[model samples]
Target chain A: MTARYLALYLPSLATDRIRRAEPGLPRSLPLATWEPFGNRRVLTAVDSAAADVGLRPGQALADAQAIAPDLLLRPADPAGDARALHALALWARRYTPLTAADPPDGLLLDITGCAHLLGGEAALLRDALVRLRQVGITTRGAVAGAAATGAALARARGDNPVVVSGIEAGVVAPLLLGPALRLPQAMLAELARLGLRRVHDLLGQPRGPLARRFGQDLLGRLDGVVGRRRVSIQPAIPPPDLAAIQDLLEPIITRTGIDAVLDRLLEDLCAGLRQAGLGARQITLTAWRVDGAVQEVAIGTGLAMRDPAHLRRLFAERLERLEPDLGFERMALEARATEPMAVAVQPSLAVGGRRDEAAMAVALAQLLDRLGQRLPVHRVAPVASHWPEHAVTAQDPHDVDPTVPPGWAAQPRPVLLLRRPAPLEVVIPLPDGPPSLLRLQGLAHRLHRVEGPLRLEPEWWRNRPNRFRRDYYQVELASGVRLWVCRTGLPGAPRWLLHGHLP
Target chain B: MPSAAPDVPLDQAAVLAALRARVTRLEGFGRAQHNLGAVPVCEGLPLPGGGLARAAVHEVLATTPGCGAAFCAVLLARTGGTILWIATGRDELMAWPPGLARCGLAPASLVIVRAERWPDALWAMEEALRCPAVTGALLALAPPPGGGKLDLTATRRLQLAAEAGGALGLVLRPDAACADHTAAVTRWRIGSLGAGHGLDDPRWQLELLRVRGGRPGGPWAVTWRAATGRLDLDKEATATGATRHAAG
Candidate 1:
C-alpha cells in the first residue's frame, strides 16, 4: 500500500544530447550549451568538464567563454531536450507502468510494486542508471517514499539513492530549498534573507507564522517532502508494447503520398507480431500532426491476424478521415491488443484461375472488417425476450454467438419497426369490434381488413403494468399498406399506438 | 480461339463496326442476358426471361416505400451467399432480424452497412458488388437530404462492378427519382394496391416502366405470398386502380 517514487534527473541533458548524437565530440573537453535569456545569451547546461572549470548554467556565455576559453560550445535545443526527456520517460515504462515527464530535464517514475523485479529499489535504480549511461545519457536517480522528496533528493539533496521515510529528516537536513521543491524563487529568496536557507531551518519554525507570512503553499510542499502528505503524480498513459514509430524528415501533407509510408510501417509492425507468434486483434495508426495535434484511426478484426495486405485494405477505408492539416510529422503503428496465434504456413501449391472457397471466406471477412471500420456493419440477432423492445439487437456480422437462434416468434414480426412508437387514433365500428378507421401522423387511413388482437402478457413474475399487457393487431389499410398496431388497457379504456410496418 | 487482342483492322469500316458491337456487348451485359440465365422473379415479369439479369443493376422506383424491402429480403435468401443491406441514415428502416427471418433471409448471411452520405452509400454498394463473397447488394437509395441525384455514370460504374464480381445489384429509390437517366437494365415502379381487409399478402400495383432490351409493360396487381415467399400475379385479387396489362 506504500507509494515509492524514483526521480531521474539529467543534469547536462542539452550538452550530453549533442555528445551522444555526435560521438566524435571529445568528452574530456569542457563543453556547455547556451540559449538566449531575456536579451543576452546564457549557459543553459554544462558538461562535467565545463563544471570542473568553474562554469555553471545561467552564467553569461561571454563570462563562461572567458573562464574556460577552450570550452566547446553548441546552441541549446530546449524543444529537443524536452522531447528527449518525454521519450526517456516513456522508455522508463520498462521499469514501471507509471512514469511522468518532469520537464527542463527530469523524469519521475512510481516504482511502487515494480522495484522487486530488478531485485529491489537500490538495484533497480542502479540498473536504470547503467542502462541510460550505456545510451550515453548521464542520469542521477533517487528513490524515496514521496515523489516530492525523491525529486528533491535526486536534483538538490545529492545524497542517498534510496531514502525510505523516517530517515528522510536526517537526510533532508542540510538540503537547501531549491527549484525541485517547486517553491517560487521569490519565496526562497525571502526565506534565505531570514537566514532560513536550509530545509531544517523551516522545518523547526512555527507553522502559524510561516502560514501568516508565506501562505500555505510553502508548508504544503515541505510536508509533502517529509512524507507527511502524499502527492500523486500524473503518469503518462503507457505506450503499446508492440509498435513501430517513424519520425519523418519532411512532414507528409498529401493523402496520395501516405500509402507508401503506411505500407512500410505496417510491414514493420506485422513483422514484430509474426516474430512473437501473435496476431493483432486490434490495431491503431496514430498520426502526430505538425501542429501538435494527434489523430488516431483504429481497426478491429473478428479473428487474430498478422496479414499486412489485409490490414492495409482495412486502413485505407478510414484513412480519409485522418486530416493531414499542415501534414503529419511522425507516425506510429501499434497493436493495442493481441492474441496468441499459430504461425501461418504458406500452402506450397499455388494455383490461380478464380478465387477459391478459402479465399472467398477470407474476402468476406476482409469486407466486413473494411466496411465495419467506416460504418455500422452488423447482423440483426434475435434476443429471447417476449418484449418487443427487447426482441432484437444489432450484432457484429462475424461474431459467433450461441444465444441467438436463426428465427424467433414464429408469428410474423414487422419489417420496419419505428424507433419510437407513435400514438394512434382509433374509431371502432362497434363497442367490442376492432377499429374501422385510424388517424396517424395526421393521415386518416380507412381500414380494409383487421387481423387478430393477439394478446401478449409480461412474464409471470414481472410486474404487469396496464400498458405492459398488450393486444397486438396486424392491420391493413384500404391502400394495401400493412401496419402492426397494439392496444393496451382493458376493453373499457383502450390506448393505441402504431408499432411497425409490414413489408 | 483467336487472341483477345481483337481481329486486326482488315477493313476500316468492318473493324469499326466490329469494335462497336464489342463495346455494346461489354457495356450492356445485362441486356444481352436479359432473356437467359436470369434469376427468376417468381411469376415472370413482362420481360422475355420472366426474371431479372443476375449480375446487373436494376432500379426500382418505389411509389410506396418504390419496392418493398420484403422483396429484397426474399432475393437475398434465394441468392444463397453473403448479402449486404446498404442504407443511409434516413432509409435504414429495415433489418429487423426476426422480420428478415420471417421473410426468408438467413440471419448469419446478412450484413448491414449504414452510410452517412449518398456518395458513401453508392461507394459501399460498389465495394460490396466487387467482393466475390457478396452474392447480392441491395441499396435503399433515398434522395439525400441535401440535393444530389444518382447519375447515369454512377449506375454504369455499379453495373461494371457487378459484372466483375458476378453479384446482383438492386437499388430502391423514391418514385420522384424516376426522371433520372440510369444505366440499369430495368426500372420498375411499384405502388401499394389498396385492397381488402386482409393485409397478409402485400399486393403491389407493379409497372415495368423501362427496360433496355425489352418493351416495358405492367400495372399488373402482383401478390407477395408470405408462406411461399414468392411473387404471384393473381387476376382474381381485388386491387384499386390496377390494370392487367402484361408484356414480353
Candidate 2:
C-alpha cells in the first residue's frame, strides 16, 4: 500500500511556546525572542504582532527594538522548543500511531489506513488543524502519498490534501524544486545560481549530472517525493495495539459530556480486547485539551479484565481528579498493559453457591477489586516459623497457600496475637509456678485457674539466639477470660508480659 | 427476657417441617439449615432461628476480657463461607491465626481487613458485607481511646448492607454499654466462667441479652469443644454472679 503522511508546520512555534507558558500575556503586544551570537544579539523569532510591525527574525535586536519600540523580548530557548514540539508529536499519536517530531516547528503523522475512523483523509486534516487552532496555535498541514511531498506542500499550500494518485510528477512540475524535494539550502542556492528554480527545469536533465552534483542526496529526495523510495520516520511513541479514540465535534466541557464520550470509547476498547481474547490489566485515558495541554489518568486492576462496566466504575472514581481546563477536543483510551483472560489462580477454598472454581475465582477477584478500591483487603498466610507472632503474615487475598501447609502445634495457641506484647506486674506465690495475680495499667486481675508452663525454645538456627526460653501459661481470670502470659527472661531476671489472648 | 416456649407439644416431623418453612421463607427455596445460615451455637441459647441470625447484624459484647473474641471466633467459623475479619484502627483485638485455627476457622478462607481509622473500618465492613462473595464480616471495634463509636445510623447501614448480600455481620465490642443504640438482630454478652473444674477446657458464659424477634435465653455455660469445633453447652450451669466470689 502507498504510504500516507501528514506534515504539521507551526511557523510561530518559538513565540507561541513563550505565550503558551504564560497564557495571560497580551496578544496585542508584539513578541520576539532574541539570542546572543558572539558579540551581537539578534532576533531569533517574532510573533505575528511583531511581524505586522515589520520586525522580522534574523534582524539585529537593537534594530528591531528601534523599529517596534513596544516589542516584548525574551531569551531564545531552543531546547525547550524542541522538547515541547516532541510532546506535541507524542500527542498526535491519538490521530495515528506513527507520529514523529519534524523538529524546529513541525510534526509528521503516518496516517495510512487510519482515515476511515474520522471519515476520509480530507476531513481528518481539517479536524486536526481546527483542534490545533483552538489551542491558540495557528498551524498549516497537508497530506500526500509521499512524506517528502507532503512536508513540502504543508509549507507552500497549507491545509490542502493531494487528492489524486500517480500525478506526483504533474503536481511537482509547476512547483519550485526546493519544495518539490527537501534539498539543502546550499544545493537550492547553487541550483538557483544556475537559473534552475522550478522542478520542471530538473525534469529535462539527466539523473547522472544531478547525482554527481548533489552527491546522491538530491536524487534520493527526488525519489522519495515521487514515491519511488519508501523512506521511514522514527515515531515518537510505539503506539498501543488496542486503543479507541474520539475527536469531538465541539469541545467537551461538562463532566456528563466527557462521561458520555468515555462510555463509547470503553465500549469499543473492551470489544476489541474481547475479540482478541485478552484483557486490560492497566489502561490510560488521555484527554487533549483545546488549549494544547494533555491530561492522562491510569487505572490498574487486580486481574486482567475486559468488562466495560467494571472498567467504567474504576475510572469514575478517578475521573473527577482531572482538570479539564478550557475543555478537551480529543480523547483516547489505550490498554497500556494486557494479559490473557485465563490467568491461573489457586482455588484453595470453596466459595459458597453452586459455582465452579473458575467462576468462583472470577467472582472473588471482582469482589476484591471493588473492595480494594476503597480499603486494603488481605489474608494471612502461615510463614514457616514457631514464634506465634511471626507464624503468619498478611498477604493479598488471592495468594495461594502451600499444598500441604505446616502442621499446627500439639498445644493450643492464642487466637489474637498482639503486635507488641503487653507487660504485666506479676505476684508469683511460687517461684517456679504461674502467677497468682496479674496487674495491668492499675487494674487488678486475680487468676481463677492456671495451666502449667509450656516451654518454647527460640529457633537456634536463627542468627540471634534466644537468651531465655519462653515459659507460657494459659491462665483464666476470675471473669473467665483467658490470657496467654509469658515469662520472657530467666527465672532470676524474669520479665512478665501478656503475649496473646485466647478465644 | 425469660419468655416461655410454646406449650403445645412439637412432634418430630412437625418441628422439622416448621424449620424447613422458616428456612425457605428467610432464605430462598431448597436452602438447607446451613445457608439464612446461622452460627451453630449449641441449643438452649435463645438465638433467632435456633442460632445467631445471618444477613443481619449481631452485637457480641465482651463482659469479660477474652470471652467476646472467643465467641466471635466460633461464630466466624460456623457461620459459613469466606470470612472478613476487620480490625478498626490500631486498638484492634485481632484473633491470632493459630488461636482462630483452634476454633476451627481455616486461615485460607479468612481475609483480615485492617483500616487506619474508625470510619474507614465501618466503611470497609459495609463494603465487605455488601459483596455476595463474602459470607461473613466481623468488625472488631474498640471503644473510646483508639476506636470510634458506631452510631445507630452506622449500624443500620451495616445491617441493610448485610441484608442485601445475605452475609452474617458480627460486631465485637469490649463492653455491653458500648453501643447504647444498636440495630443488631441479637445482642450477646460473653463472659468467662473459668476453666471447667480443671480439665484444661475453659468454659464461657453466654448471655442472650436481647433479641429483635426471638425471646432471649442463656447465661448458659459452654465449653469450647475442639474435636467437634462446636460449643458444648451445660444445661445446669445458668447461674448469675457465679464469678463474684472469685473476683476478690
Candidate 3:
C-alpha cells in the first residue's frame, strides 16, 4: 500500500516544555536552556525572547553569556522533553493511532487513510498546529504523498507545508541541500566549498562524483527526501486487538452516567468477542475528556472472560480513581491480549460435570479481579529443583495446565522462608560442637536437641566464582519452637543465620 | 391468640420446635452447613459439625514476631489452594518461601502482599477474602502507633466477604486489648509452648479467647506437626504451661 505521512516539528520544543510545565514563567523573560557537553555547557534551546537577544542554540554558554548577560538559564532536560513529545503522540491517537515520537521535538504520524477523519490533510495539520499552539507549543507541520522523511524535511526547510501529489521532485528541488539532507558538517562544508548548496545544484551535477565524494549517505538521504525510499514510523503502543468507540453529544460527569456509558461500551466489546469466540484477558477503558485530555484505566483477569457485568464491576472498582476534567465527551473500550474461550462443560445430572470445581475457579477469578486493585496476584507453582529456596516459583494463575503436575523437592522445607537469611547469635561450646543457646531479637533460647549440619555446597558454575558453603541444621528450642538455621563460611569461623522455621 | 392454633397436632408442634432449635444453633453466618471435612482443625472448636467451619473469619493474636505468622501460615497450609498473605508494617519483617514450606505450605501457593499501613492491610485482607480463588487469607497487622485498633464493623465486613466467597479469613493482630470486641467467629491467642520431644512436634499454647455459639476453653497444650498440618491435643502435658504465656 502507498504511504502518506505527516511530520510535526516543534521548533521551540525545549522552551515550550519549560513554559508548559511552569505556566507562571513570564514570557517576556529571555530564557535559554543549556546542557553539559564534554567539559563545557552549551545552549541546547532558546525562547523567542532569548533569540531576539542574538542567542542561538548550540552556542557555548560563555559566548551566549557574553551576548545576553540577563538571560535566564535552566538546565535542559532531554528526557522530560522526549516524554512531552511522546505524550503529544498519545494525544494525536485521537486522529490516528499510527503515531510515533520523533525524539527531542517532533512527532511523525501516518495519515494515509486517517486524513478524512479530521476533514482532510490540510485541515488536520492546521487544527493540530492550532491545538499545539494553544498548549504553548509552537509547531511546524508538513504533509507529503511520500514517506515520513520527506514530510519531516519539508517541515524543517520548505516554505510550503503541503507538497502536491506526484510532484515530489519539483517540491524538493528548490530546498537547500544542507537542511534537506542530514550529512556530516565536514561533508556539508566540502559541498559548500564546491559551490553545491541548493538541491537543484546537486541534482544538476553528475551523480557519480557526488556519490564518490560524500559516500552513499548524501545520496541515500536525498533519495529519502524525494519519496524514492520509504521512511516508516514505529508507533509507541500497539493497536488494540478490538476496540469499541462511543462519541457523546453531551459530556457526562456523574458516576452513574459514566458507569452507564462504560457498561454499554463493555457490552459492545463483549458482543464482538462472542462473535469471534475469543475472550480478553486484559481490557482498557479510555475516557477522552472535554479539555483535550485522555484518562485511561486498565484491568487484567487471570482467566479470559467476556462477561459484561463482571467486567463492569472490575471497572467500577477503578472508576472512582479516574478524575475526569469537567467531564468526558467520548469513551473507548479496547480488548487486548485475547485468548480462545474454554469450552464450558455442560452440567449433567449424573456425573455433575465437575460443577463445583468450575464454580470455584470462577469465584477465584472474580476474587482476583476485585483484589487486583490494591495488589498484583500470582500463582505459586513448584519447580523441579533440589535447593529449598529455588524449589518453587510464581506463575500467572491463568496459565493453568492440568496435565503438567507440580514437581516437589525430596526434602522438607520450612513453613515460612525469610526474605533473606538473618544472622542469629549463638554460643558454641568449641570449634566443632553444636550451639547450646541461640539468641534472636533480644531473646535467648536454650537449644534442646541438635540436628546434623547437612552440608550443601554452592552451584559455583551458576553463581559467583567464590561462594560460601551452607551447613543447614534443624534445631528445637526449649520454648517448643523449631527453627531452620544455617552456617556459612569456613568450618572454623562459620556464621549462623536463622533461615526458616517449622511454624 | 389461641384461636388460630387450635387445630395443630401435638406431634407436629414438637417437630416444629426441634427444627427451630436446630436453626438457632446454626445461626452463626460463617458456620459451615456443608463441607465440614474440608478443614480438620476446626473439629476441635465448639462450632457445629465439630469443626472451625469454612467461610468464616478467625483471629489469632501473637505477642512475638514469628509465632503468629507461623500458626496462621500452618492453618492456611491445611487448606488446599492459593493463600493470600497481607502483611502490614515494614513488610521486611514477614517470612518468605522456605519458612512457609517448613510450615507445610508450598511456597508456590502463597501470594505475599505488603501494605505499608495497617488499614490498607485490613482492606486488602477483606478484598482477598472476597476472592474465591483465595482458599484462605492471612493478614498480619501490628497495632498502629496512632489509630490501629480494629473494631467490630471492620471485622464484620471481612466476615461477610469470607462467607460469600466460601473462604477462611485469619487476622494476626498483635494487640491483645481489642480481642473481645472483634466480630470474628473465633479468636485464639497463640504463643510458643517451646519445643516438644520429637522432630516435627512443635507445641503451642492455644488460648481460645472467644467463640460465638460455642464454648471457648483453650490455653490448651497442643502439639502442631507440620507434616500432618494438624494440631494434636497434648493430653499428657498440663495446660499450666500457658499460665505465663501471652499473645496478642
Candidate 4:
C-alpha cells in the first residue's frame, strides 16, 4: 500500500485575540495597533485602510495620527496576546506534543500520530475548526504532505479546506502556482510570460537552465515543499512538575494579599515537591503583575527542604523586601531540587541517636537569614608553622571535622596575632638579652619578665624569594600585661621590630 | 620555687562535674551557638573558662594594601558553612591562600559574586546573609565612603541577620582606620610580612585594634610557608635557635 503524508495548517484561525479582533474593525476606518517600546510606544499592526492612508509602523504617533486624521488606533498588548497564544498552545498539546507557536498569531501542530484518535484526518480538521469557530475564531485549514504546501494552501486557497493525499513530491508538485509557490511577483509574472506559471511547468525543465536563471534558494524552497529536504523547529523548554501557581478572580493589590497568595503558592509548591518525593533547596517565586511586568523573589536553602511552612516563611522574609506595584494577577513558584535528599525513615531506638545534621543545617540557615552573615561560628585551623601569621586559618563549622584537635590544645600561643610584623627600634640593655626598653609605634615600654625568642624561617622551595626571619617573644611588662612581640631577621641582622601582643 | 603537691587525677564523678562545668562555660561564653569567637568592638573582654572569650563581633581593619584580607575573608566565609564573597570595584582585594581550603573551607563552595557598585555589593551581601539556604558566610569589602566605619544601623541589621541565620559576616576594610562609631566586634589590621631568608618561610603580622571579648592593640608575628599557606607564630626562641644552628 502506498503511504500518504498529511500536513495540517490553521490560518486565520484567530489562535490569538488580536487576530480575531482584526476582522471586527470597520474595513473603511483607518485602524492601527501600538506596541510597547522602551518607556513609550511604537506601531505594531496596521489595517488596510490605515495602510491605504499612508500610515505605517515606526512612524511617530503624532505623525501617524496626522497622516490618518480619522484613524481608530488601539494600543497593542503583546503580553496579552502571548498569554492567549500560550493558552492555545496548551489546548493544542492535547492533539500533539509537537505543537508550537509561530508567534503573534499562528500555531503549528504536527498531528502525525494523533489524527486517528479524532476519527481520521478530515474529521480531526473539521473538529478543530468547529471548536475554534465556537469560540468565535475564524480559521482555515489545509492538509498536505509538506508543511510549506499546507501553509500556502491554507493561506491562498478558498475557505473550503484543502486536503492533499500522497507525499509532497508526487501530489503537491502539480498544485503549486501563483503565491502558493512563493515565487516573487516579478518572477511569477516572467514565468507566466514564459508559459510556465505552474510549478509542474518548471518541474520538467532542465536543472541547469533553472539554476542559470533563478537562484538555488528557489529550488531549495521547492525541494522543501516537496519533502526532499528536512526542516528543524525549535521547541519550548518543558516546565518542571514542581510548579506553584495562583489564579485570582480579582487582581490583588495590597502587600498582605500578595503575601497570602504567595503563601498559598508555596503550599502548592511544597505539595508538588512532596508528590514528586523530592525537596527544593532553591526556589524562585514570580509575581506576575496585571501590567505585564514580573517581580521575582528567589530563596536558597542550606539543605533540601519540603516543609510548606518553612518555605512560606523563607518567601515571606524576601517578600518583605519587595515593593509591589500595579497589583499582581498571578503568582508562580518554581522549585528546583538541589542535592537529592535521602528518604525519610523512622529512627531506630536501639542506639542513642544524635541530632540530625539536616536539622542543624536548617536551623543554621534560619540563623544566617536573620543574622547577616557573621554569626555562625567556624573553627580556625592552625597550620604547622612557627610564624604567628601563617599558623592559623578559619574554616566553616560544617567543614570542620568534629574529631579534629582543638585550636588552643596544641601549643601555648599568644592571645594576639598580627597580620604582619611591623619594624620597630629596640635598644637592648644587655646585648643578647631581651630589650630593657623597647620603642614601638613611637612609644617606649620597659621590659620586665621576658621569654625566649621563637624564630620562624620561610619556605625555600617556593617560587618567591624570602627576605627576613622572625623571632617571636612573650614578654610581661612591669604592670603584668603580657605582650606577644616579634623581631625580624637573625640576631645579628640589625633589624628588630615589634610584631603583636597576647590579649 | 616551692612546687605544688603531686597532681591528683579527679574521680569519675568529679571528672563528669568538671566536664559539665566546662561545657556550661563554653556554652555561656557564646550564648548563641553561632556567635562564638565573635570579638567585641571595645576592650576589657570577659574571659570564659578554658581561655575562651564571650561571644562578640571581631573586626579586622587593615591599612596596608595586599595583606591577609583574603585569608580573613576565607575564615569568615566558613562561619556560615558556605560563604558568599561579594566583590565590588576591585577584584584582587582579598588574597585567599590554598591552605585555607585545607583548613575547612571548601573552595568550590565559595560563592564569589561580583557587583558593579559598593552599595549593590552590600545589598547582595545582606541578601546572601538573609538566605537560609546559603548557609554560608558573607564577606564584603567595606563601602568606600565609610573609611573603615560601616553604617552602625546597617551593621546592626547585618549582625541581627547573622545572629538569626547563624552565618558570620566578615567585612574586609582595606586601608581602614579605627573609628569610634564602627560597630565591629573586633577590629584588626593584617599585613604581609617580609620574606624570610633563603629556604625560610613567609612571615605576616596581624594587629588586633579592638577585641570584644579579648584584649586589643600590639602586633603578632606569623609565618606563612608557601608549601602550606597555614599561619604560624614567629617566636623569639625559634629565631635564636635558627641563628645558633644556621638551620630553620
TM-score for chain A in each prediction: 0.57, 0.64, 0.84, 0.49
Looking at model 3, residue A163 earns an lDDT score of 68
The CAPRI category of model 4 is incorrect
TM-scores, each model vs. reference: 0.66, 0.69, 0.82, 0.49
Pairwise TM-score winner, candidates 1 and 3:
3
Worst 10 residues of 1 chain A by lDDT: A342-351
* Model 1 agreement with the true structure over A1-503: per-residue lDDT tens digits: 68889988888888878997888987789988888999999998899989998998889999998898899999988889888777777567666768999877789999988899879999999988887787678888899888878888887845537987667767766787774466777888898899988888989999999999999888898887777788898876654758877768899988876787889999999999989878888888878765445677888987677899999988887899899988987788889889886322221222453336556766777778877777777876777777777786788788644355444657767766766777899998787568889997688989987887888887766565554677888887877677889887676788888888776
Model 3: lDDT of residue B115: 72
Docking class of 2: medium
Instruction: Residues B1-248, candidate 4: write the lDDT tens digits.
Output: 87665676548898877886667555333445544454221123233332223222345555433334434543554354556655555432233323334333444455445554556565666666655545544444543553223678767666556555545566666644435456655566766443444223434555666654346544556554434534555677335533654553
Residue pairs that clash (backbone atoms under 3 angstroms), model 1: A448-B197, A449-B197, A479-B194, B61-B66, B62-B66, B63-B66
Candidate 3 global lDDT: 0.74
lDDT of 2 by residue, A1-503 (tens): 76788888888998988887888888899999999998999999999899998988789999999998989999999999998898898778777889999877788899989988879888899888887887667788888777766776776564466545567666766677765565777888999998889877877779998888778877777777666777788898667768998989899999999899999999999999989989898888999887777788888787888889988987887899778877988899999889887644323333444235555566667777766766778887877777776677888776756332557533677777667888889899978778999997798989887886888888777767555688899988776678889998876889998888765
Candidates 2 and 3 compared by lDDT, better number = 2
At residue A361, candidate 1 shows an lDDT of 64
Off by over 4 Å in 1: A1-152, A155-241, A250-260, A275-277, A287-295, A317-329, A340-355, A400-407, A458-467, A489-493, B1-37, B44-50, B143-148, B193-199, B235-248
DockQ (C-alpha based) per candidate is: 0.36, 0.52, 0.37, 0.05
lDDT of 3 at A350: 22
The candidate scoring highest on lDDT is 2
Give per-residue lDDT, candidate 2, residue B7.
85
